[model samples]
Target: MQRLVKIEMSLFKDILSGISGIFSGSPYRIILSAENKKFYLNAYKGAGAIPFAQLLNKYPQLGDLSVWVNYEKGGTVIPLGNLAYVKKELARLISEEQKNKPEIVIPQEIQQLKPSKMPAGFEIRYSWNDSEKAIQPQLRGEYWGEGTYVSENSYWNMPGFTENDDLWLRKNKIRGQEILEFLRAILPQWQRRSLPVQSEVVLEAEPACTIKINRVRIDSVTCEALWRVNPGSIAEIPSLAGYIIAGSSLGEGFNPAGLPLQTESGQALVEEYIPKTIEKVNEFLLQQHHLGMLDMFQPS
Candidate 1:
């Protein structure tokens, strides 16, 4: 006997939120790697990770979601066409079921709707026991630099909260020291070390930016710096694998090292402002260079 299941809204939250743009009826394809599978699987355990081509073949009804699985390159690609029609069909099915408040019904349990086949190129290498034994990400300490620096003066003191202010000021100092210590710990060992610093600015409702400085040397003059802002926070910058965020070269003596802006601003922003920000970031890096920070990347 077929069972009727009322779909939960939360089950499809991510899929709906992400797939909405496809409804424009524009065709699109997405290629996902094994690492990508792990990330999505971790986020949506119920949906699980399956090969795109295999999935479509098993559920021929989802033919509109064309897919290709490449074994050589270890990737699965999904092409979304007739997306608008798919949305319409889904809406109609939901409407036809129990017509009271617009709920969708399926023949089997909702969780059972997981992809039946693993994508051709990828496999779940880790078992449940292995995952439980995997190393967890470590919590990083925060560093407050200029924000914590205060001069001993009345102007620097807040009214009616001297003690709290002083304590924060002290905490900032502690963070500054911790920042240096953390940097020392993660410093990469490489020959021909030179520091490369880069920054990205996200112009949202609340403007925010991040500056990354790599401290591992890869060449005689180019080194990588480990840079992160808002460490251990929700907005922490993701680790970029096999990607160099920025490139730099040693500057002439008495001159600051040259660094370039590594940001992608949407076309909306004025073009002229981009260079001005690059200049500002380079100037900031130059200040740090003069303070012997860049020396840490030199071959020991």
Candidate 2:
């Protein structure tokens, strides 16, 4: 790799690349920033392997390379330039992503439950299929409390969702420049054989009414009922609960409840409340969706 970059640099010295650095992360990056001329050259290996790593001493470090773009003094960028040999591309630098592009971690903007986007009663599900290379934004019907369900399907006098299914929220519009900029930044961070992945956000037309069952104290049984909530978002309508969060200090105003430990009493309720609260909360959530979702709750 270094050998090929050195060869490419020497060929363009005092010409294409007046100032150069051999390695800037993987894939040699050469930024030709002139007042008028500006070209970004990204170079890497083609069908070539590092002779040292695999101990392929006799095999060439770099054989055939596809050098493209205007820096090419020889072949075309696509069909023609794809035929250049490593020895042939002394005119242009080579990168690792010759035939295939590198994979990177997906940005948060694209894959998260955007809190800011929630207008009152709508949470966007941003997802992507990397295998198919497609970006699809979905309207997963989720909102904390009640305000106005803003979607194309939502009507002025629509009843509450009753069907046991994913209540698809329609008529939500979204546009974020940060998502694009985040995507562009990851292009350089992409690794040779990895995949990208995202998880939350807020847009102009979105919303969060989730009670994070958090353990506020690590040394004791102290908890914060709901912290990641909007002030006006509680009790208006039953909101969904998130996963249980642990690890905090027994701070001021926190009353550590005393309970019968499993070993200390005939029946244990110490480690039971939070977990049971989670179950009951979620159970109640289902009942709120519609009637007859459950015949009975868990027995005491």
TM-scores of the candidates are: 0.16, 0.14
lDDT of 1 by residue, 30-114 (tens): 2221122110111111233445555445434445434221233444322112223333454554455331221222212322332
Considering summed lDDT, which 10 consecutive residues are worst modelled in model 1?
Answer: 247-256
Q: How well does model 1 score by local distance difference test?
A: 0.27
Worst 10 residues of 2 by lDDT: 243-252
Supply the TM-score for candidate 1: 0.16
* Candidate 2 Cα outliers beyond 4 Å, as residue runs: 1-207, 210-233, 236-272, 284-300
What lDDT would candidate 2 get against the real structure?
A: 0.28
Clashes of each: 11, 29
Q: Give per-residue lDDT, candidate 1, residue 267.
A: 19
